[model samples]
Target: MADVARLAGVSAQTVSRVSNGYAGVNEETRRAVLDAMKELDYRPNSAARALKRGEFRTIGVITFTLATTGNVRTLEAIATAAAREGYAVTLLPVALPTQDEVRGAFSRLEELAVDAVIVIMEVHLLDAVTLTLPPHVQVVVVDSDAGNHYTVVDTDQAGGTRAAVRHLLDLGHETVWHLGGPEDSFAAQRRADAWRAALAEAGRTAPPLVRGDWSAESGYRAGLQLAEAPGCGAVFVANDQMALGLLRALHERGLRVPEDVSVIGFDDIPEASSFLPPLTTVHQDFAEVGRLCVAAVLRKVRQEEPERGTTLVPTRLVLRASTAGPGRRDAE
Candidate 1:
């Protein structure tokens, strides 16, 4: 610090202000301090600073698994947003959604230097576990229904699902069939519930709800069964992977898409546009969701009134070749 101050021709206090990112220093002085830092190879001790300021400038993230596209994409977005905010991220992957697993994750976090936590489970097992978190550590959750209790940032699952079903019904399908993800997934349940509500509102009877493990293979298996169902004209899948599988099953069954069936999917994964007959689906603003989560959590970290209830990032319906009016060849 003395060497940097001497080299930059500034007092040690000025150097401290620049090093700590305190805002009073002018741009020229800041640049000179930075040049001195670079030339002298002087690095500030972050741990010492953290101890003094009571802030680690780190955010911890917890998630069950990264096998799913939504989790990985959202995690990436959160990391990017955190970096932009000059904060580092620490990730702790819980092996399961069980309360024990969640509690274990919290125990592990206790050993880390995180100032706040962001849990990306999209599961409802955190309500009890959240109460056990350190009081100083503000938490923001993703993809769960704990909004009434904790700060939440998630996609508008119900809104997106309604749009998907409405699109299919307006295209002349008598009723839309739902190929839902795992029953325990909050997102999947929201989508399934919305699908039923949308159908009911349209005065259309919903067909049996098919279950998938969020896998294309599961979707393919479900598709085979649906292919045998009477009056199966349009389907809304939980995610894009399953939608891909459903398309293949339909193809194997010699059913032409749009000509025989219409398919809609969620997430709008990158490959969605290139699927055999591109997938019409719900476009989740994952980056936006991630950014908002960081913002909300950091607000608490900064000791602002923490956001309660849910902050829903809106989704859009992406039009593609996979959907059309019943028996029509072109997409709507």
Candidate 2:
């Protein structure tokens, strides 16, 4: 910073204001400071900056895989929102979720002196480590109910699944079979719960649950089971990706969608509607989830109380051609 100031022919305070992105610095001065910084290859020490201002403009986000389509969309939203608010994000990958790994990651973020942290991991075990975060640093968990003191932003998984079931029922399906995501995921659990509740509400028995690991293969296996099961005319898959696999499996089994089996999936991913028999699925705005999570962290850093202890972003039901009335059940 001193080098930048010297090169720019400005006082240290002026350099500080420019580096901290204070609005009072004139555009010309800000540009000059930036050019000088580029020439000198000067990098502001975020830790030192935090020490001076009692907050870091940097946030740490811990999550499982950014490889997944849903996860990537969520991350993009987080990055966009953080940048708009003049905060830089540092992503910490929790490759394999274990208690020790999660705790260690948070401890490292704390040591890095991030002002606030957001955990986007979806597994249940994260709850234990998240609950122990230092009180001074604010934390928010995405897509899980960890019972932590800090904020939690989750998708209305149950509600979305319920909507899918209701859609099928309204189409006159006798019952909706469920192909669920991995058993360990909070999302999978919530969707399963909702599907069950919706069935019970309609005075119908919930079909046996078939599990998938949010993958095409898992969905294929579950779809195979459904294809052979008698009276299986309608199926609700937990995610779009799995639905794709399920579709393929059903196709191989000579089961025509809607004509033979009506399949509805969750998470109306970009490709869902383009499948061989366009998918009917639930859509979740994960990007909104990410943006809100970052905003929540900012509120904590600004010493403002966030309105909700836990925020659940709503999901919408997308109707495509994949699902229709449960046509002509095979006579007993």
Candidate 3:
């Protein structure tokens, strides 16, 4: 600390501000402090500082898994937003979110004495674990309602699915087939519900629901079956990765996209556009979701009154070449 302060020609308090991400330091001083720290190879002892301050100036995030593109994007956005607020983020990934695993992660965070916790476990099992957190710890849930009391931030999965199905219906398609995500996921259930409701509202026979584990391979398997089925003109996939797989499967089966099938997917990932035919999908603003979650949880931690309920982030459809008119060659 002394060496960095001497080299940067700033007080110890200024060095502390630079390390803790406390605002109010001028740009020149902040740059000089960073340069000095880099030259001296001085690493701030986060643990020691956290112990002394009773506040880590850091938050812990728990996610069910990082296997899917949506999960990964949400976590990245949360980290980026937290850093901008001068808080560090620590991610805790749970491969299989058993009761013990969730409990254990919270216990560990309790020991670290972090300011708050954000759990991204989007399954039903997480609710059991969240009920037992120590009262002092403020918790915010992502994509799942932990309970009515704690803060919850969720994407408008149902609304997005409704939009996609309605779009297909307006395009003169009689009915839309659904390629759903894992049964355990809250998002998949919401999407499936909305898809069914839209069909029911129009007095149409709801097509058989195809299930996937949010993987491209599973979507490809479902696609193979749907491609062979009669009157399967339009499909709404749960996520883009599976949509990519379905597109490939249709191509290999000598079926033409938009000509033989029109598909819509969720999560407008960057790769969606670069596909052989650009993908038509829904966009979830994960960065906004992250920012909302952080601000929500921190408000509770700071003893400020924030809206005490769930927040739904809006989604939009990005139409692309993957969807088009049903051709005259439909199997009768």
Candidate 4:
């Protein structure tokens, strides 16, 4: 520390301020300190600093998987938000959704050098035993029904599903068929329940649900079944990737989108607008969800009482060419 300070002609405190990214260091002096450190190949001792401060300025993220678009997007947002807040994120990936795997991840929390944790996993996987974490480690959860026990941040999945279903119904479709995601996913379950509720509210019975594994392939399979079924005019797919597969299956079955079977999907991913006919879908604010997760965890870290109950980032319906009135069949 003194060698770089001597080289830069700055005090040890000035070097510390520059290294820690603290304000009040002039640009020229900061640049000189950085140049000296680079020349000397000096690295700040993060562990020593953390020990002195009593906080690591690091966050641990535990998740079962990042296979889905929602998970990947949410994680990306979390990382970005953490970086803006000057905190590092350490991901602890669980091999499975089992309670044992989650427990194993939690057990190693102290060793991970994180002051707080944000868990992004299905709520059901967090049993009573697995929910327990090491003492003094604050937590915030995403996409789980852990609001009653932990600070929760998530998209308004049910509200998004309702908007999609209602949009289809308002287009004169008698009943909207559903292509749901996996049975175990809390987000998927919420969407499915909302779809049903929206249908019942309109005094219409929902068609049998066709479940998918949140994959384009699973959606293709489910699409094949829907294509073969009679009275399958409007469909509400759980996600955009699945909707991509469903669109393919319908096209192959001599069915034209909107003209034959109007479709609406969730998660207005970037590619949604580039689909064959473009996708009219639900847009979730994943970045907001991530920002809230970091904010909530930092609140706990600061000994502040985070607001209990779920913080739902609202979603909106995006209109595109994929959906239309049933009477538009001959227009295609």
lDDT of each: 0.89, 0.83, 0.85, 0.89
lDDT tens digits by residue: candidate 1, 19-83: 98899999999999999999999999999999898889899999988989999999999999999
Q: Across residues 64-108, which tens digit of lDDT does each residue of candidate 2 receive?
A: 877555677777788889999989888889777776777788888
Q: Which 10 successive residues of model 3 have the least lDDT summed? A: 125-134
**Candidate 3: residue pairs that collide:** none
Ranking by lDDT: 1, 4, 3, 2
In terms of lDDT, model 4 sits at 0.89
Segments in model 3 whose C-alpha atoms lie over 4 Å from true places: 1-47, 125-134, 329-331
lDDT of 3 by residue, 1-332 (tens): 99999999999899999998999999999999999999999999977987897777888998888988878988998888889888888887866667678778988877766788998867763445543445566888887745476678889988899899988888778888999999889788889999999888877779899999998899899889888878888999999989988998889888898888889999998999998689999999999999998888778778885776779999999999988776543433
**Candidate ordering by TM-score (highest first):** 1, 4, 2, 3
Per-candidate count of clashing residue pairs (backbone under 3 Å): 0, 0, 0, 0
Model 3's alpha-carbon lDDT is 0.85
Q: Which stretches of candidate 2 lie over 4 Å from their true place?
A: 1-48, 125-132, 329-332
The candidate 2 region of ten consecutive residues with least summed lDDT is: 125-134
